[model samples]
Target: MARKLPELKRRKPSIAEQQRFILICEGEKTEIAYFKALKAQYRSAQISIEYVAPAGVPITIMDKVKARMAELRREQRSNPSVKADTVWAVFDRDEHHKVTEAIAGRQVSGAQVAYSNPCFEVWLVLHHEDYHASDDHHQVQKRYQKLDRAYDPDGSKTPDCGFLMNRVEEAENRGERQCKSREDEGMPFGRPSTTVYNLTRAIRAAAEASRPKRS
Candidate 1:
């Protein structure tokens, strides 16, 4: 008598869980466009980036972020599947008051802040070179324009994502080094600096973590 052999079934590979980040931006067009470009460049099944543009000063922006965080909390309570792993308020110190207050509020709420001195354009400039000179919003715009001729000072143009994508790591490195230098010089909250690198670092980490492991 011959024994019948059983067929083996293969198990499906497991996918990494997705992480969601909610970014509350101060600029309606430029900031939104930049973050959207970043999201597209890092497209991954396990990472989600959402943007909210309230278009206001630092204090007002924080207010909107707090409200949104509350709404997210309520949704999460109703459905555990709905989650926001990180909440970030993106703003620049462009003649706006209450910058310190906004930073303090984020600390209390356990949220993050991607703050740039003069304007967000400073972060873009770091992609090309290390900029230590103090600049106002207008000056930083010119600096960015010089580095990226396609950059528009007005909010009409979208950033060149493809161009910026290749230089992101360089920008992060320059930004971190500048910040560290400032901190060491007893000017922890000095101008000509940005914390936008922190946000981008988190995004990269989340995307990397979501990638499947190979045996």
Candidate 2:
């Protein structure tokens, strides 16, 4: 018999890289808080959400995002392998002149915008029922209260991201319908429209997809 058999080398399994996301929002409270809750809900180590400082206006928010991104690039000089899959700026058009500028400005840094015309509340209201009005910030809240009885009219109460997330699909479909209607009316990305659902869906899907499959 052959004395010594050659030892076989075992192959190492491939480990997929984590999906990286950098989210910058105009609102310090709602957008930031909502995204934070969303990230926690997934509880996936394969997904990363970078935090940027709170900004008030759309242009200012874009400024902060670009600054942070510049910092990241400098960091890459040392790390040499750091990369971000997506960098998104979430903002609303609430009579702010800079909103349009900010959305168009994303081309400079290659960042994407999850824009909601009129206000972010449009996206939030969609979670409850169908809304196609180009309502201002206040009206959006009123509509949201109809769905969420616990909603507080005063500034004291915070957003209900958990409740909204539970019906994310419904909200997403409604938002799509609104956008489609706007587009058909020659007003794409105009009032009564929101692209927040696009960002949410991508985050949820990518977070789940990056995880290793279990037998």
Task: Please list the C-alpha lDDT of all candidates, in the order they appear.
Answer: 0.81, 0.76
Clashing pairs for model 1 are none
After superposing all C-alphas onto the true structure, candidate 2 shows an RMSD in angstroms of 3.8
lDDT of 1: 0.81
For this target, which candidate reaches the highest lDDT against the unseen true structure? 1
Q: What TM-score does candidate 1 reach? A: 0.88
Tens digits of per-residue lDDT for model 1, 18-73: 77778878776667777887888777633334454446788887887788778878
Q: How many pairs of residues in model 1 come into backbone collision?
A: 0
Q: All candidates: CA RMSD in angstroms?
A: 2.6, 3.8
The candidate that achieves the highest TM-score relative to the unseen native structure: 1
